[model samples]
Target: MRWTALYARSRHLTVALAAVLLCAAVLPLLLGDSWSTVFATVTLGAAVAVAGVGLSGQDLDLDRTASFRWPPRRLTHLLVIGVVAGGVMLAAQGLADLPIDSSWILRDVAGLLGLTGLAATLFGGQFGWTLPMGWAMTAALVPKAVGQAYDVVAWPMATADSAQAWWVAGLLFVAGTAAYTMAGAHR
Candidate 1:
């Protein structure tokens, strides 16, 4: 078997990918005409949360002992999660003729993937879904108040063009990516 296939199997990537694809494909269709930024945020968050489970392998010590470098692999894993989640959602929305903006999907996927990475780094890979799901739920529930504070707090649900939302998402993406790449999921 190929090294890539072995790595993917060890990380349960197939299960995570299936779950992400399912969420991305089904959520928007269920929402139908009522789809909006909030639903999009939730859908993306769920997809990322599901895929993030594979951020770390079953045995951290064994993984660390591997001869190959880990940083690049970790970075690629995160990027792939974002790409797959975002790409599936975009395709689903396009097929259904939903009104979700591509920009919003991009921003939310990046931010949510970052949050998952951060969660994995801090709480271990098994718990990586917590941060993204928690933030998405909070954003969906919070009232839409005006101002930078609200935008930052509810970045996931913010409009596609909101400057504050973009900044927060970008910062999270950079910080989470850097931290996770430098330090694989917490032992």
Candidate 2:
């Protein structure tokens, strides 16, 4: 599949996968839940950063020329970008021995997709990781943002008690996807 082709050539994807693997092996065993959160933030922070893999001026033109699945190349590629990052989240969770709450972590993944997509659209993939990573680090280390903004900010931080978090995360995912697709379409 064309998605496979894109993934094979993506340095961002490569690094993201490697990071998830390393964190899975080391973080849970070495530290407590605090470090696990740190890992979660960092890994999900990769949302947009991973999109950087095949994104460039040249890559845009290439995508325009190549037709993948039913969706436009841009849409499919971005979808794959999100999906791969989400998979990394799942792997990290399983390895870390976190509870099997799909909605909780999935909301995080969806929110990340949105953040990463938004970052990639606004800033370009060159600095895709900057905003999300900054947000993640702040959320993890600062404590203030994480507690208050978990639901407000969206992402995995949203507690399990609220169904609203799922809606917010889905909104983020759609918004981010639209932004990315529109940006590429216009350019």
Which is the leading candidate under lDDT? 1
**Model 2 TM:** 0.68
Cα displacement (angstroms), candidate 1, residue 45, comes to 0.3
For model 1, name the residue pairs that clash. none
TM-score of each: 0.96, 0.68
Question: Hey, what RMSD does candidate 2 come out at?
Answer: 4.1
Instruction: Write model 2 residue lDDT over 1-187, tens digit each, in one string.
Output: 7666564565355665565445433444455465545565565665445454344343556655655442455567666766666665576567666653546556666666666667777777665556556666655664434564565654455465667667776887898778866674223
Candidates in order have lDDT scores of 0.90, 0.58
The whole-model C-alpha lDDT of candidate 2 against the native structure comes to 0.58
Consecutive 10-residue window with the lowest summed lDDT within model 1: 142-151
**lDDT of candidate 1 over 1-187, digit per residue (tens):** 4868978998899999999988998888888989887888888899999988888899999899988899999999999999999999999988899988899899998889889999999998988899999999899988876666878999998889999999999989988888899998998
